[model samples]
Target: YLKKIGRRGKIDIWLVDGAKIRRDLEKDFTNFAEYYYFPIIPKYEFWIDRESVPNERRFFIDHLLAEWRLMDGGMSYQRAKEIANQKELSERKKAGDLEKVINQKSEFSPEKVHRRLLDKTKDEIDIWLVDGRLVRSAFDIGFTEGGHDLVYQYVPKNEVWIDDDVFAKERPYVLLHELYERSLMKSGLTYLRAHRKASRLEWRARHSEQILDEFFLKFLIKKGKI
Candidate 1:
């Protein structure tokens, strides 16, 4: 649930209980420390996950504000996010607590999954846990915690990948997001549309565990595995 903390200039700041969010969503590395959406409030509302330490909170806030402004100025979200990430990276480096990890993984190497498969049903799609950091380093640097075949490189034709970095409690939410996004794409939704809807579902899942149960149930029903 979101609690209004205060106003930041013209934007409303809300605090999210990130642990509860993780527990409710059943995901590990969903990795959204802060985010903002337009028209959800008067102009924009900024949300920060309470899981962030005090020293890290301001950096996330700075990133959100920068991202919001860039998007407001007609910049693409991808470009804006890249710039914001760079900004945050620079800030963290300045704080002297940032250590860039060197990825030694190979692109074509057979990576092991944390588990065999999320569900083994009649459906052809297979979901597996993967080293998301390695994937990002060797395959696509833009790779996040969750990804699937349609919009990503290196993924097989009918597979969903969950980052092994995600917490055991939160893996389910990330799986839900990847599965929903893939389903929407297969149903002919554009990647952008499908991604937006999936992102919203992920957000809702963060707030309510019931949503997770209902979504998984629907998924099982669709797979005829119920």
Candidate 2:
């Protein structure tokens, strides 16, 4: 009964339910096609009851839009690099390292230190630590908050922040540093590499949400009411 229809990760299957045939047919012919396909027709009137749609459907659609906005031109690679460089310089100034800080202003202006960090990549552990530090710093800045009162409001241009209260209260930076360092020491680079790979996977997932939505729409259409 469970015949394999495709390769793994892209498999499809058909199910039959004699007892619930009426319910299944109603869904296939009316509910699914009405909500998904009727909207496609130029002059077709489609009425969807808000309470009828599944929660997962709404979640998927909303998440797709959110990811699309995040990866839009507003947060381009050049913008990210510029923000990172400015924040690094500001931190140096705050730490009274102004005298030692470099004056050049190109992509590789702080060449020595940047090169040092890049060279310290003895293993994946080092890269994970760097990524953890970046995440911890963002958390300290109130970027994790749910409202408009977050650090993002005041520091609108940059996507990172340094909230004094949050930093003092939770000390997430120290915790993350300790946790990652301990994980690195105990498990070697395996866990660290997994973390890095997971981060990349997350980015890809966010970027591909729109494609997934289109796929779902196509599925609904192929089932009939297009």
Candidate 3:
């Protein structure tokens, strides 16, 4: 059941279960995601565990908060634990006010970590190429031993590292889409929220770039350059 819930600022939000597709159609979650240009939320599956929590009951965040795990001000589970370990954080939870954990001043901020890793300006682009062993290090958590394709760390404030999975020109297109969507982020939306909203626009950006490429090719052909 595909549905458009609403808009989170300038971006549109859609809801669908990547795992639950028509069994008879021979479709896959990754294919469905690529077909829609949406991100796959591994946390939803809880690692193959059966879960169907209602909207109201699905409070907090955890497991792996990558593309889809991104909430406006959500913190990583490890960061949460670091907070939980803090003497002051424990007091807040005892007072039934643990939500403040996100407000504290400390390191382990996944976004901040990513930002530092990027260490680039809005106009600058950084691409890292590492082996499979460093995949988990890049994420600090996620990225199991199995391996993964191109990963958009988040906003351009973060670096996009490509593993040894045969890097090519396609990476630039993905990077462009990420940068474009991040550019669309307005004053109110958080980086995470902005990404979920930019899903649709990302595809459009990619297609437009392709159109320009075709135009350039035609021009070159007319000049007999190719």
- Give me the candidate number with maximum lDDT: 1
Candidate 2, 1-226: lDDT as tens digits: 1222222122222222211221222222211111222333122222221211122222222222232233343565445434543454345345444333234552211212211121111122221112212221222221221111111233222112222112122222222222333334345555456445433432333345554344324323211111
Residues forming the 10-long window of minimal summed lDDT in candidate 3: 55-64
Full-model lDDT, candidate 3: 0.32
In TM-score terms, candidate 1 sits at 0.53
Q: Which ten-residue region of model 1 has the weakest summed lDDT?
A: 98-107
Question: In terms of TM-score, which candidate is stronger, 1 or 3?
Answer: 1
- Candidate 3's TM-score reads 0.31
- Model 2 scores a TM of 0.20
How many clashes (backbone atoms < 3 Å, residues ≥3 apart in a chain or on different chains) does model 3 have?
0
Error of 2 at 111 (Å): 22
lDDT tens digits, residues 1-226, model 1? 4677667788887776555644454334233433334332345577565532233556667777788889888888889888987776666557543122332552254243334465632366777766654454445545656788888856877888876655556667777788889889989999999988987898788788789888877766232221
